[model samples]
Structure formats: structure tokens, C-alpha cells
Target: MEIYQAFLVALVACFGKFTGDIGYFMFDRPIVLVPLTGLMLGDLQQGLLLGAELELVFLGIVSIGGATPADVNMGSVLASAFAISMGAGTDVALALAFPIGVLLQMVKMLIYFFRATTMHKVEEYAEKAEFDKITFMHFGHCAIYVSVYGIIAFCSLVFGADAIRSIVEAIPQVVMDGLQATSNMLPAVGFALLLNMLWDKKLAILLLFGFVLSSYLQLPVLAVSIIALTIGLIMIAQDRSSSKTAVQTTGEINEEEDFFNA
Candidate 1:
């Protein structure tokens, strides 16, 4: 692709990361953004397939306590673009995406660390009730986010793809195989992390139930979700019914005591 085209693609892709948390656009999701990146590169099918795979890889990665394992946005955009541009297969693309995700995560965290300084400015505004000034400070912070995530993505998509393709092409067979192997392991890692986060002794039965539905019965995810929701609603209704019964019983006991007193 031409330089301007790559830049545009990159700029749009950055929303998958930089501006992702800002609004309803939801460009940060791999399922949504990767395909768009692929469309920009004239290979929407490949992009969608790659996006699905990446989503699985990063599914367990969430920002708990204000830290994520990787930069989901930059990873999806750059990996899909670089892979499609080079005609690399899915495995290689996944391998490339993993490292880039971690790298970009570090970059983002560094920017965040520095951005914390601006909190003082926000505090100063709060003291005086200068709401407009505080809002402007927020805009300035967002501009910083755009500069870091968006500009970096634009540069990478426009200028780095060809070089990355060249380097990937030159990698030795053994190292390439290792990367492919690592790619295969990523999904399992993601799932395991998710399980660790969600696991609780009290809720173990729910996990087991889901496992049975998925592994033994081979139910579709939508079906499983519907069943789970139904169970939750039923439980809620039962709880409400029990509370009502207890209230009625108490009222009846009070009436009997009044009759005795009269």
C-alpha cells in the first residue's frame, strides 16, 4: 500500500487502543477492529480470521487493579496489518502480535506513569471549582493519549510493515518453529488466566456446569448463556418468594398475639 494509505489505516487502528476507552466506538475490540484493518489492507477475510484468533489469545487479559497483561489494541492493529501486508500465515501473525502487545503495554504504562503528574493540575482546578479548566486538562490528556498510541501506530503501519516482512522472511527455521509453537500455547494460557480470575469455591459448580455444557454436550455458547441467565432469574425469583413467605408468616404471628392480648 502507499504511504498515505498506510498512515490512514494506522490512524484508524489506533482507536482500537488509544481512544478505545473514550466512547461508544469500541474500536479496541479485536473482533471489530482487526477486520477493519484487514479491509483497509484489502484482505478482510484474513483479517477477520486473525482477529478471532487474537481475541481468544487475549480473552483472559483484563485490567484488574489498573493493569493489563498487554496492549490489546495496538497488538491487534499492527499484527493484522503486518501479517496481511506480508502475506504471513495466521500462526506467524499470532507470534508477532504477542510481542508487540507486550511492548505496547509497556509503552502505555510508561505514558500513564508520567500522565499521573497531571492529577495535581486537576486537583488545583478542583480547589477553585474551575470545572472548565479541569475539562480542558482532560482533553489535553486525551491528546497525549492520541499522540502516543495513534502516532506510534501510524508510523508502524506506514513505514514498518515492509521492514518487518523482510525480517520475518529472514528468520531461521528453528526460531520460526518456536514462534509458531508459542502461538499455539497462547490460547491455553489465556483460558487458564481467565479461570484463575473467576474461580471461587462457592461458584465451582457453575464452572463445572459450563464445562459440561461446552465439552460434553457441545452446546453453542449462546445456548449456554441463555441457560445460565434462566437459572439466575429463577434463583432470584425463588429468593423473592421465600422473603415474601417469611414476611407473611411474621404478620400472621403478630395477629395471633394481638388476639390473645385482647
Candidate 2:
């Protein structure tokens, strides 16, 4: 790509990723933004694949209590673009992306730490109940965050891509093998995290049903999802029926007591 084109691409990619990051924070998802980045880069297929894999890897990852998790947006955008640009496979891209994502997370944590320092001013404003000052503080903090992201994006475009490609090309076969090995192991990590979220005893039967359907019956995910939806509807109907019966029984008991009192 020409220097001007590269700059344009970088700016657009950065803005797309930034938008995605904001969406992730609000909607708790990064998948929506990855495809947009890919589309901007003229590689929608690679973008979709990268997004899906990243989503799986971070399936159980959540930001709770102001904690930062891995920066999925940066990871997906950088890795997907690099992968498509370099003609690398999905697995290789994923292998490279995971660590980069974690590094981005660290960067984000540092940003958050700086933002925290500014929060004291907001707190002081709150003490005076100056709502406008509190609002300005929030806006100022967000502007700083977005500006930092834009700078990173611009710098990465200007200096990072060629260097990254050179490094990947120069990597030894042994190291490449190690990356592949790590890539293979990453899905297990993702699954383990998902298991943590879905370990409920009450949902054990449904889980088993899905497992059996997928593993033994070899059903497609679409088929399994449909079955699960049907099961959910049935269960909901049964619960409603039971609730109605309970209400009727309670009403009869109340009537009986009233009649006896009369």
C-alpha cells in the first residue's frame, strides 16, 4: 500500500476498532466491530473468521468491578489485518493475536490507572454537588482515552506493520511450531473459561443434552440451537401452567376459609 493509502487505512481501522471497543464496553461483545474493520481493509472473510475465533477465545471473559480483560478489539483488528496482508492462516493469526491482545490489555490498564487519578477531581466536584463539573470530567477522560487510541492506531500504521511482517518472516521453524502448539492449547483455555460460566447443576441436563446432540449425534450447531429453543419454550409453558395451578389452589383455600368464617 502507498503511504497515503496506508495512513487512511490505519485511521479508518483505528476508528472502527475504537467504535468496536466502545460497543464492547456497552454491549459486552467485540464480534460486531471485527467485521467492520475487515470490510474497511477489503478482507471481510478474514475479518469474520478472526472475529469468530477471538470471540470463542474470550467467550467467558468479562470485565467486572472495573477490571480490564484482554483487549479483544486491538487483537482482532491487528491480527486479522496482518494475517490477511501477509497471507497467513487463521491459526497463525490467532497464535500471534492472543499475546498481542494481552499486551493491549496491559496498555489499557495503564490508561485506566491514569484515568483513576482524574476521578478524584470528579469526586471533589460531586462533594460540592456540581453536576456540570462531574460531567466535564467524564467527557475529558473519554476524550483522552479516544485520543490515545487514535495515536496508537496511527503509529502502528506508520511504523508497525512492516516490522511485524519482517519479524514473523524471520521467526524460526521451531518457534513457529511452538506458536502452533500454543494456538492448539488456546481453545482449551477458552472452553475452561466457558465451563466456569456454565457450571450450574440445574442446567446440567440441558448441558448434557447439548453435549450428546453435538458429540454423539453429530448435529450441526444450527440444529442444536433450534432444539434448545424448542426445549426452552416447552419448559416456559410448563412453568406458566404450574404457576396458574398454584394460584387456583390458593384461591380455593382462601374461599374455603372465608366461607367458614361467614
Candidate 3:
């Protein structure tokens, strides 16, 4: 990649981190970042396709509390950069993204680890009523967190791109096929993970209905979405009617009880 292109990738990575700091607008997602990275690299179409595919793999990943998921932002940026700049395929990008994300997640933990160790300073500031210093540390931490990822992005693209391309060129056909197969299966895995988190007995019937519509009846996604929306509206209306009836019944009972007392 050219120096300016590499710088742009790093800049995009910085923006990805910035989004998370400022209320998580989801600009860091693979689907969003990859296209932006691709645009910077002059391969928007490939970036878009790869970004869509990568989104499936990372779809179910959510960082709850202190837990860190893979660094999708870093992985998507670098993988798309390598794939675009090196003229590699989507499979290569998919193969590259997950491991890279997983590996970089450790770096994220280290950042968190150091930040955690500094809580005492914040505590001391709080005890001393140094609110300004505490505020300064918060912004400083955000800047440092964002810059570290940006530097990683820039260096990885500039320094590591050639090495990765060379390795990709040397890999055997069988291994490549395996990687492609795995890539194909990853979306299902992502969906399964998401379902595991969201599963409820009440929603199982709806899930099956959508599955049958899409799988058996060959209904398009738009049709299924509209059907689901209709069902949801019906359910909402039923609940509202039930609530009104119960309220009216309760009011009648209260009035009858007061009449008897009088």
C-alpha cells in the first residue's frame, strides 16, 4: 500500500475507536469499516462484499461488561487492506480477519489492564476533589486508546502486508479450500451465537415461521419481514385490548364494593 493509503487505513481505525468512545454508533463494525477501508484503497466493491461477509462472522460478538470480543475494527481494516492492495480473494480476507481479530483482542486486554491499574490515581483524585484531573484522565485515556489502535493499523498495513501476501501465495490448494469452507460456515455460527443469546420459548414459534417461509416457501426476506411486522402489530393490539378489559373490570368491581359499603 502507498504511504497515504496506509495512513488513511490508520485514520479509519482511529475513527472506529472514536465511535465506540462516543456512544458506540457502530461505525466500528466490519460492514461499515471494511467499505471505508476499501474506499481508501480504491476498491470499494471488493471492500463492500468482503465487509458483508465479515459482518456475518462478527455478527454475534458483543462485549458485555469487562469482556472483550475480537477486535473486529482492527481485523476488518487490515484484512480488507491486504485483500484489496494485494489482489487477494474474499476467502483470503475472511481467513485473515478472524485470527487477526482474535490476536489483537489480547492487545485490547492489555490496554484495559493498564487502565485498571491506574484506578487508584482516579480514586485519589476523587478523594482530593480533583474533579478536573479526573475529567482530564478520562479524555486522555480515550485518546491513548484510540491512538494505539491507529498505530497498530498503520504499521500492520505498511509493514505486514507484503509478508501476508507472500504467505497467502504460498498456501496449498487444499488448505485454501478448507479456509473457504470455514468461511462459508462462519455466518451460520455467528447467527447461532446470536440466537443462543436471544432464544426464548415464546419466540420459538415465530422463529420457526420465518425459517419455514424463507426455507420451504421460498419467501423473500422483505416478505418475511412484513409478515413478522404484521404479527407483532396484531399481538400488540391484543395486549392493549386485554389491558383495557382488565382495567374496566377492576373499576366495576371497585365501584360495586363502594356501593355495598355505603
- Whichever of 2 and 3 has more TM-score, that candidate is 3
Each prediction's RMSD over C-alphas, in Å, is 4.0, 3.7, 3.0
What C-alpha root-mean-square deviation, in Å, does candidate 3 show against the real structure?
A: 3.0
lDDT measured at residue 247 in model 1 versus the true structure, 0 to 100: 100
Best by lDDT: 3
Query: Model 1 over residues 31-112: C-alpha lDDT tens digits?
Result: 7788888888788899888888787788787777756777776787788788888788667777677789899988888878
Model 2, span 100-203: residue lDDT tens:
77987787788789988778788788899999988777767666776676677567656787888888888887888887677667767877898887688988
lDDT measured at residue 132 in model 3 versus the true structure, 0 to 100: 100
| CA lDDT, candidate 2, residue 133 | 88
For 103-213, candidate 3 gives per-residue lDDT tens digits of 889988888788899989999999999999999998888899999999998889889988998889998989999988988999899899999999999999999999999
Clashing pairs in 2: none
lDDT of 2: 0.72
Candidate 3, which segments miss by more than 4 Å at Cα?
Answer: 65-67, 226-262
What's the C-alpha lDDT at position 240 in model 3? 100
* Two-way lDDT contest, 2 vs 3, winner: 3
